[model samples]
Target: MFDRFKERTPVRDSLTFLEPNPMRILILLFITIATYAFAKEKMFGNGSLPAFLKHFDTNSDDLIDEEERQAIRDLRAKLREKRRTSIDLDQDGEISENEVSMARAALREQIEQRRLQKFSSIAGEDDLISREEYTTIPGVRNLPDFIFDAVWRRLDTDESGYISPEEFLSRLLKH
Candidate 1:
């Protein structure tokens, strides 16, 4: 090919060997710019893409070369490490959809259990909160043991052997 081209070198060669032919220079410049623009748009548009897939398909073939496949495996390992840190609550260094769901379910169950415990404490021994109970004691009110026994005795109006939770709350709050 070199033998085919004429030896009439231009003064512009001093600037760049490529500048000898303005058309050749323009064509080369165009090719370089087009290649850069295509590479940028096709591959790096979103940083979210897995690195291997971006570089593997220069000709746009779906399958990656062996080298690219190796690269992909390496990249996947690094990404998996990052993902494990992000989602693996147990810190086992592996991430799975089930683990994520399990973590969420555990948190929800904890919240629900706390809610049940809170409600149970509010109800105390009554099991159910009576309407008047909240009004009588807005906050925690200490009841003397003697007073409680006396009140219990009175609440067992029929002289039943024991006072039920309902009877106890009803009698205590009404007064």
Candidate 2:
């Protein structure tokens, strides 16, 4: 009878101990957080898409072409690496969820600022970007000559071959 009672005590103690294990709890927390993050990314496609669109729509046409997509991917990778290196407070090689969120937010802000600067420069004094004005931008000038005129032409709605500030903002910022 004493042996059986001792066995019962050990079994109950083991069960109680397992329930509050710190390592087990940590593993569970990590799994839950990771699952949530993966699902969120899959559903949302980069957290905030307005930021992505603003950055990737090089011609302000509200469409991301193959080249533009590749460019954006490259830019995103660079920005992520830069921010991770700077923001990883723990010095762990891996960035935490909070750190990644912070990096993404900063990246979004940078993209927005760059867009505003480029818009102001491209708009010039007239507040509208003429086809000629668009081509004058350094970035536009660097694009392949064949693709350059084509992209600008596509963005010039109404077949007017000119882009108004309203059109530019609407297309780029609409998301």
Candidate 3:
């Protein structure tokens, strides 16, 4: 009985169940590579430099000359005053810990609301954003294909070729 049981199957045939799915392997590999590319882009890529120059470089020379530097300083001072006024809930010109906490909570709510609005705007009536729709997002159309694709893959966690509002909001909030 033991000999009969052991005699028939080939090793390769028996182990076929253990073979990896090519599609699954490919997806895993893609996710790993895309994650690495996204991280590298965030760390070593232009970051906020372009936006900074665009806002402060009034002359459009791509360089922050002394005048622009002074403008930035003035803007920072104005922003600081604005923030102080907002945070000092009692109008006492000083922000208490309670006021700080309240202001922080309000800011968080505002950010969440803005993100929801963005998701609604992008998703449109279909309530789903395809890769094409994603490219239409502000600043996304200008990205290199590789970087854009990596970001898309990272956001489309379900690999459904579309981004659901949950995915969009969660991914953005995480970062």
Candidate 2: list runs displaced more than 4 Å: 1-94, 139-146, 157-160, 164-175
The model with the greater lDDT, 1 or 3, is 3
Q: What's model 2's lDDT at 58?
A: 70
TM-score of each: 0.26, 0.37, 0.49
Output the lDDT of residue 2, model 3.
Answer: 72
lDDT of 3 by residue, 1-175 (tens): 5776656479757876667987568768977886665675457656434552477878777678899899977986898799789899899878899998999899998998898888889889998999888878889999999999899998999999989988988898899
Clashing pairs in 1: none
Among the numbered candidates, top TM-score falls to: 3
TM-score: the better of candidates 1 and 2: 2
Segments of candidate 3 deviating more than 4 angstroms? 1-82
| Residue 11 in candidate 1, Cα distance off native in Å | 42
Query: Candidate 1 residues 22-134, lDDT tens each?
Result: 65786689778867766764575553433435676555555577876777678768986775576787677776788889867877777666755654665568564443343
Error of 2 at 170 (Å): 8.0
Alpha-carbon lDDT, every model:
0.60, 0.73, 0.82
- Per-candidate clashes come to 0, 0, 0
TM-score, ranked from best to worst: 3, 2, 1
Candidate 1 TM-score, C-alpha based: 0.26
